[model samples]
Target: MFQSFTPLNDKVRLCQGCDLPIRVQQELPYGKNAYCPRCGTQLSRGGSPSLSGNLALAITCLLLFIPAFIFPFISIHLLGVTFSATVPEGAWNLMSHGFPLLSLLVLFCSVIAPIVLCAALVVCHLALHKHWFTGMKLGTTIIYRLKPWAMIDVFLVSVAVACFKLKDYSDIIVGPALYALIVLQLLSVLLISRVSLRRYWEAWRPEHTFEHQSKERHCIYCHLSQPVGTHCQRCHQPLHHRKPRSLERTLAYLLAASLAIFPANLIPISILITNGQRLEDTIYSGVISLFNSQMPGIAIIIFVASILVPMAKILGLGYLLVCAHWRKERFQRQRMKIYFVVKVIGKWSMLDLFVISIMLTLVDRGQILDFVPGIGAIAFGLVVFLTLLATESLDSRLLWDNHPNSPTSGRSINER
Candidate 1:
C-alpha cells in the first residue's frame, strides 16, 4: 500500500544544500544512498521508511516527557543542606531571579519545543497513514521548524558540565528524571534522523515526482520540478531560483551577533559571593577558573563552546557572505563545508547558559555561597541566538550560484 516516488530516468533532483540539479537513479537499492555530485549533500537514501514505526517512536517520546520534565532531575548537597529541582523548576528559578528572557528560553528549548516536535511528528505520520492530507503539511512544517530548537540533548550535555563544575563543592545526586531525559534525548535523535522530510513529501504526492523534462524550475523543499513562478504542489512554498535576500539577512544577523559577542566575553557572566566577599567571572576568567580547579577538560569545552565557537561563527559567516555576495568561485566546496559546520555547532554554544541555569539553582545559600547571573549572560545568549538565525537565513545555494562549473550558475532566476 506504500508506494514510493520513483522518478523518470531523465528527471532532475535539486540538491537543497547547494541547489545543484542532479539526475539520479530511478530506483536506488535498499540501504544505499545517493549523494549530490557537486556539494556531497546526501540526495536520497534507499529504504522502506515506515510511517507507523516513526509514529510509534514519536508516541514513546511523548509518553516519556512526564518523567523527563516533571520529577526531580538533579540535586545538590552542600553544608548539610540538600536542594533539588526538576527541569522546569530550574527555568522557574531563573524567572524568579528576574531573568525572564533566559528562563523563557530554557522553557522553550527544553520543554515546549521537544513536546511540539514529538507531537508534530506523531500528527504528521498519523495524517499520512490515515490518508488525511489536511494536517499533514502543517505537521511537517512544525516538525522541521522545531527540530533545531528542541535542545534536549544539548541540555543533557549541559547537565553533565554542571555536574562536573559542582562536583568539587557538593554531592550531586542524579534523579530518575535525568535517566528519563537521557532516554528521551536518544529517542528524539533517532526519530528526527529516521523520518526523512523529502520521503514524506514524496509519499504525500507520488504523482508530483520528477516526471517532467524541464530542469528550469524546481521546489527546494519537495524537490519537485515545476513551472516558473508557481508554488510547489507538495510543500506550497514559492518557487524562487534562490532564497530572496539571503546575503542581506545573514549580514544583519552577523553584525548584531558581533556587537553582542564583545559584552558577552568582556563582562562577568556570573557573580559568586562567599562570606561577604565577592568574585566575578567573565567568559575568559571562567575558563581559567575551571582550569585552576583542575577541570582542564571542562575548561576547554567551555572555551570552545562559549568563547571560540561564537567568534568562529561570526568570522566564518562573514567570510561566506562576502564570497557569496561577490560570487567568488574558488573553494566553493570548502565554503560549503564551513557552512555545514556553522549550522551544526550553532546550538552547542548555549552550554554556558545551561550551566549557569543549573548552577543558580544549586549554589544560592545567601552570602555563604550565592551565585547570581550577570548582564553578560544576556548578551552571550543573544550571540548564540543571532548566530543561529544567521546560519539558517543564508542560502547555501548562493555559494554555488557563481561557480563556473555549477549547473545553476548560468541562469539567474528561474527555478528552486
Candidate 2:
C-alpha cells in the first residue's frame, strides 16, 4: 500500500521553515530545502509576483474566450457568392462533404477543445482568486487534462492550409474570430508562463505546525536517514539533490527527433493532378505551388506548420535538455518553462497530419484533378508522433537540481 507522510509523527524531522517532515536528505554544496513527503508542502519559502501575473492573464483569457467562439473565423467568396465559417461551420462543411471523421476532428480540435481549455483556465483563476489553495489541486488536474485536447494552434495550421488550397479558386477573407483565436492562443501562453506550480506550492502550504523532536530523520526513499546513506528505494540512487539522468534522456530524445526530421520533411507528401496532368509535390513544392497560384497567405501557413514549427519544437527541446544536462541551468524556475513549451507545441506538429486528411477528402474530384497522399505524409506523421512521445518522456524536474533549497524526497526527482 502506498503511504503519504503526515504531521502525526512524534519525532518530527521538520522542514527548516514550514515545520513539515524532511521527506529526504539533501546533498552537500546545494543546501536543498526539505519538504513534507506526502503533501509536498515546503518548510520555508518566499512569495513570487508570478502567481499574481498568472491569475491576471488567466482572467483576461477567459474574457477573450467568448468572442473567439461566437464570431466567424473565415469567409470564402466564390464568383460573387459568399460563404463564411465559424468554427462549428467548418465542422459541418467537412461532414456535409462526406468526411465525417475529418469533420469531428476539426470540430474537436478547433471548437470543443478550445472552449474546454479556456473554461478550465477560468475555473483555475477563480479558485486562485478565492484563495482556495486546496481547490487548485483539482484545477491543476483539469488544466493538465485540457492541455492535450486544446488544439487551437493545430486548427490555425489547418485554416492556413485551407486558405492556401482554396486561394486559386476563390477569394479568402480573415475574420474577427481568427484574430480572437490568435489572441486566445497568446493569452493561454502568457497564463501558462506566469504560474509556477512549485513556487505556488511553497507559498500556499496548508497551515500546520509541528514541534521538532530529536530523532534520526529517515529518508523517504531508503527509509534510512542515517548519515552518509547509500541508495534510495524510490529512485534507487546514491542520493543526490538532483536527478542524474534527466539531462541525458532529454538530450537523447531531442537528438533522435532532430535526426528523424530530415526524412520526414524531404519526402513527397502528396501527388496532385490538375487538368489530367500529373504533378508530384513535396511539402515545400506544394506550398510553392500554392503561392505561385496566388495564395501567399496560405503558403506562409503551410511553411509554418509543416516545416518551421516542428523544427522549432525539436530545437527548443534539444536546447533545454542540453542546458539541463550541463547542470548550469537553474532547474526549478525553468522547469515550468520547458514543460509549457513542450505541452503547448506538441500538437502543432499534427498540422501535416491535418493537411493530409483534408487533402485526401477534398481533392477527390473524380475526373478533373485528383490528390493522393504520398510517402512524405506517412513519414511526417510518424515524426510528429515520435516527437510528441519524446516530449512526454522528458522529465521537467531535471532543470531544478541547482535550486539552493529543493526538497529531499527520493520521489522529488521523479515529480513532474
Candidate 3:
C-alpha cells in the first residue's frame, strides 16, 4: 500500500532494503521522512545537516560512560550478607570463572561498543565540522559498523530482568551507577537513532546528479551512486551489483547457528548452588522456574528474547535464502518485512547472556549462594552472535534481482 513517487530528475538513491532505485529530491522538508515505495525502507529523514548537535550528544555520553561502569550498579542482600556488582566487575567475574567468551561478549556489548560509538561520533562530527578530512571517513565508517552492536538499552532491560529473577530470594538495592546507566542508555539511543551515514556523507559533500546508466552500482555503506566495478567515491568500499557471495555467506552463518542452537536450549545455561544443594537450569527450565515463581511476565520476556527470537531468525533467514536462491518472486515484500524483523530482534537474543553476567556478579557468596554460567551459555551466546552475522551478511536486495517485475528487470517497480 505504499505510494510511488515519480522520478523528477537524475537524483536517485538505491533503497538499501529492497534494492530498488528511488528518485528523490536532494533534500526533504524539515521533519519529513522518505520511505521506499516498494518495500518501505527509510530512504531519508529530514533534519539539519549540522554536525554540532551530534558532536555535543556524543561528548556528553563519553563524559557519563565512566561513572556508569565504575560505580556499583546494584547491591544484593541475602541472609545478612550484602554484595554489590559493577558492570566491569560482572565481566571480570565471568572471565575469572572461565567463561572468557561470555565475559568479552558482555563487555563489548555493554561497555566497549558504546564507548566506541560515542568516541567515533565525537571524532567524526568534529572532523567534518572543522573540515579535517584525514580521519572523517574512517571514523564515520566505524560508527556505522559498530552502531548495531551497541546495546546499552538492551543491557538496561537485562538489568531489570536480573533483579526480577533475584528479588524473590534477595533484597535488591538500586545504586547510583544504575541511574547513570539509565541516562547513558537514553542518550545512546537518541544519538544512535539520529545518526545516518548518508546524511553525514552529504554534509561532507553535497549529492551530485549523475547520468542514469545501464551498469550502475549504489554503495550500501555510504549510499552513493557510482559506476559498477568501481569503489564508492565517498566511503571507498568496493561496489557490487549485489553483495558478493551473499547467499553462500548467509547459508554458512545460518547453518552454524542451526547447529549451535540445539545445545544452547537443551543444556544448562545457568547453575545455582545454595544451602548445600546444586541446581542447574536450561533455557526452557529457567522459563518454567520463573513461571512457577509467579513471574510469568518476566518468564515470557526471557522466553521470547532467548528461545523464540533465535528460532525465528534462523527459520526466517533460511526461508528467505531458499526463495532468493531459487528466484521465487512471490512475497518479496513480505520477505523484506521478515528480514527487517530478523535484523532488529537479533540483538535482543543477547538479553539472557547479559542476565547471566549480572547474576554471576550478584550471587557469588561462596557456599551460601553462588551462580555459575553453564556450558549452554557459551553456545547460546555463539548462536546470538552468528545469527547477527547471518542477518548482516544476507543481502535483501538479492530477493528482488531475479524478479521479472522488479526495477532491475527493466520495469519501473514504483509505477502504479
lDDT of each: 0.80, 0.57, 0.83
**Model 3 accuracy (lDDT, Cα):** 0.83
Error in Å for residue 70 of model 2: 4.8
Candidate number of the best lDDT:
3
Using lDDT as the measure, name the better of candidate 1 and candidate 3.
3
Error of 3 at 395 (Å): 0.8
Candidate 2 residue pairs that clash = 18-43, 33-405, 331-399, 331-400, 332-400
Q: What TM-scores do the predictions have?
A: 0.92, 0.53, 0.93
lDDT of 3 by residue, 1-416 (tens): 11223344255566777656666655676777777777777877775656677788899999898899999999999888888999888789989999888889889988999999889887887778688876687788788788879998889999999999888779999999999999998888988888888878777776674444432567887787655666777677777878889999999999999999999999999998877889999999999999999999999999999999999999999999999889886888889899889988989998999899899999984748888999999999999989988998898888877655443422322321
Stretches off by above 4 angstroms in model 1 are: 1-10, 207-211, 365-367, 405-416
**lDDT ranking, high to low:** 3, 1, 2
lDDT, candidate 2, 1-416, per-residue tens: 11224443332343321222343322212334444443343432232355657666776776776777677777766546556666665456556645565456656666676566656655655665686754655555566555565676676768777666766655787889889888888877666544444344334431123232332233332222222235532223355333346556656666777776776778777777777788888878888887888777777877887787778778777766666567553333444555566666678767765665545444444635466666666557656655666676565544443434434432431122
Which stretches of model 2 miss by more than 4 angstroms? 1-63, 88-109, 125-135, 145-165, 199-203, 206-280, 288-348, 353-379, 396-416
Local lDDT at 234 for model 2: 25
Compared with the true structure, what per-residue lDDT tens digits does model 1 show for residues 1-416?
01112344255556677755565555676777777667767767666777778889999999999998888889988788988778887788889998998888888888899999889887887787788776787788887778778888889989999899878767999888999999999999998888787778778877344455445555655666554566776678777877779888889999999999999999999998876878899999999999999999999999999988999999999999999889897898899899889888888898889888888887875737788899899999899989988998899888877666544432212211
Evaluated against the true structure, the overall lDDT of model 1 is 0.80
In terms of TM-score, which candidate is stronger, 1 or 2? 1
